[model samples]
Target: MQFESVSESRLSFVVCFIAAFVGCAPLLQAQTEPAAPHTFFRVKAAETLTAPVSGRLLLFLKPGSGDKEVSIDEFHPTATYVAAQEIHDLEPGEEVEVNADQLAFPKAFSELNGGLYEVQAVLDTDHNYNYAGRAPEDWISNVMALAGWKPGSTAEPELVLDHHPEEDAQRKAAYEKLKGTATADVARLEEFESPALTRFWGRPTKVRAWVILPPDYVKSGGKYPTVYWTHGFGGEIDSALVSGLRIYERMKAGKMPPMIWVMLDESCPQGTHEFADSVNDGPWGTALTAEFIPWLEKKYRMDARRDGRFVQGHSSGGWASLQLEVNYPKVFGGTWSTSPDPSDFHDFTGIDLYADHANVYHRPDGSAYPIMRDKGQVLATAEQFTRLEQVLGPYGGQMTSFDWVFSPKSVSGAPEAMFDRVTGDVDPKVVAYWQEHWDLAHVVSTHWADRGADLKGRIHVYVGTADTFYLDGAAHKFDAVLKGLGADAHFTYIPDRTHFDLYGVGDDRQGLFDEIGQQMWDVARPGKSWKNRQ
Candidate 1:
């Protein structure tokens, strides 16, 4: 007030003060920029495979460094509804829990029944569980590929996107084309009836088990010896159409002995179950022996006795088959396991080492942090990290299998186990837990032979030298242990072939096929005029 009638200098100072207060000058600004609103991820939801299944539900809000919250209201109440969008907070590297749930509707639509639905989760952040740009061949994509999931056509869609209308149309068109085509039909393999989706081990599982009618089924009502074929990791019951049994089909047409082949689905919901008894996980070992075998015998006209039955699988399934034969020698007369997970602590290639160390056995503090991504000593390059991720994706997705089979629950009801790979500098308590349940070094030597006495002359084992997965060492160690036990175990190592090559349509496919069939025949008939023994 006193300076109201001041000179030009005072007047200029008062005007500038008012201008700053009124935001007319550079000094005046909003308290804070409205932070880039947390954008939710947009996932596309398809209504193809929703019959009795409730309304088309969208899973939202994944964990670990991404968006944490999701809203379902954005999902299209009608047709093209936005399924889910994740709310994110911009921050440094952080971990979070990702989640999704099925949206339930009271009724089922009859028209839209029994078809496959392709849903997509748009990855908004550059931080993918497996970064696509840096490592294109990571596990997330590979598992999706195996499960028949394809990307949407949109420009870098959100974390999860429903398969676009065009993609679905393209899939139908491709299916029709393949169905009617008469070109070199290398892709078409055998198809069989898959049983209804039933609950096994408290999870949704489908068993596509079949019985090959004995050659003299019409002539003789008598039961025939049966070969119970269990498949390896990711190996479906239908894979036998491309395996040794496929050649057995050809051999039966000529001179192969007439035996019944029952290919059982050894896979649970999480994929391969390793076919073993578990504490927290479902009892696959009991399920295989009690549920599957009994179900097969009751359904098919075959000798239900042990002498007429056999079991076989490769890799993890190989380990399952061998362990099952040993555990239930009276239940199965013989077993042929290939590239088994036999050596426990001594074999460095077990499951514990390969898992994302962060997810392996946890500490009392709830963190299972690894000292380093590679062996505790070695460092991995970006490319190596990518490859290690690729390898781990398959095994990690199937973690339930290993966790259930090898690592039983502790007194506290937690998975308290560790593999030798991570055992060197890992938590001593976790290592003790693993040692208590499945120290294969002790199990294989102490119990395997005693349990497998009935299978002395019938056990057959094999592994490939160039097996891509370094699993041959465990298999070799297993062979030596079985021989030491005075059990009649046979082994064959295929030269110049990797694990992947031997399972699929290999260059020496026919020869490999023939050899496997001969082994089956030897177990089935005891005396057969087939080849491949030499």
Candidate 2:
């Protein structure tokens, strides 16, 4: 299982607590605090940085020297609009020099689709853009130091990244409390007994499922056409009703057709994966289909044959849906996917293409800010960077879902390759692994003709034009590849929507639900005309 970040209420409480402990009245009040004055330093590229691809370069200061804290859009000079970091406290006549080979940036210009880039540094205090509130323009000074700082005979001032220890603790605490409370109410899981179940992975894996009987289930001995609803990353078992509460509420209230909807928690321990068959992560694909489905069929009183079963999901789940149809068509009748990740690695090259920043750091002309520099000075100690690391590190240095699934080991003796998000480069092997397994375009084409006959009229896909991620590009590629392979698949694009907006809670969500429900009905029964079947 994928876990969404902690709930908002809990995060709020945590933020308040941190502010109090850190001597800030509260996050809101602290925001109003005046920025400190400081002399600016310069950062010059030891050399002209070039993009490995076409992605833009990011030269932003990370909030606390951690990936999560960096918040990319902030701190970077180019991404000033994303979220600015605050700078504090610097006396005149003091200078801090930054070094090269430590600044992290996309290696090429194509990583983020021309988004803003930032050059970041830690600061004594989080002053953000306001650090210069009353200071003279020292743009030249700042850029020069950023290029590379040589050791001076005089003692250097202490440069430091700001820390919000109290706030971070508070947020984490709140999230834990909320998760415990919410999951406490989860429905009890039942024991499984299915012979078709070849194997079970993940050791006594937390298997819990809710079987949605047909509207007329009770009167009909619980026999009904069944559809298994799986979720994408950051999904929990209850996320269906939690995140999709609005949509489910409308469906139950008659805004859309009612059918048996069985939602399974595809959420794994680490939170997410491409849901591919990886020795690195164990056999999730096998477990999901062979074990999970068989257990559901045996436990519930319903139609157990493939003809009566359908599968669907969104985002990564959407990709899973199609995978089921293509790889296990005999087990599933039809599939509905919305905003799926790319099915082919080549297509992914066009989606959120990232540059390899590590190479840039190696250039003789490429200068970088040492990880120790804070806004433009040397850090006092490693402890300081550690403090910043906790908040800003992506995954919050918490149990990263990726590591749990892909990497599987700390810097210790683990089986797979994983990178320390902070000091390590992106593991090329891991990236390659994901590309090989997760690319649908590749899978579909390679096996299409042989299996295309089995997928006719069974695949239905939808995507939003403004997808926050790269799903749109992936969908287009998938469609093109399928069309060329003689597979019967349908594609739909919803306008005026981003990723979150498309999948978010709304009354108009019926249109989306209707699309899935209709697709399920058409494939499960294969006879009556679906109202809007394309």
Residue 212 CA displacement from its true place in model 1, Å: 3.1
| Runs off by more than 4 Å, candidate 2 | 1-202, 243-251, 273-275, 349-436, 503-507, 528-534
Q: Total clashing residue pairs per candidate?
A: 23, 73
> lDDT per prediction?
0.46, 0.46
Tens digit of lDDT per residue, candidate 2, span 34-102? 633222223222222221111111123322221333333212223221211222223333333432112
Worst 10 residues of 1 by lDDT: 1-10
Q: Evaluate residue 486 in candidate 2 and report its C-alpha lDDT on the 0 to 100 scale.
A: 70
The number of residue pairs in model 1 that clash at the backbone is: 23
Supply the global lDDT for candidate 2. 0.46
Error of 2 at 153 (Å): 20
How many steric overlaps does candidate 2 have?
A: 73
lDDT of 1 at 147: 23
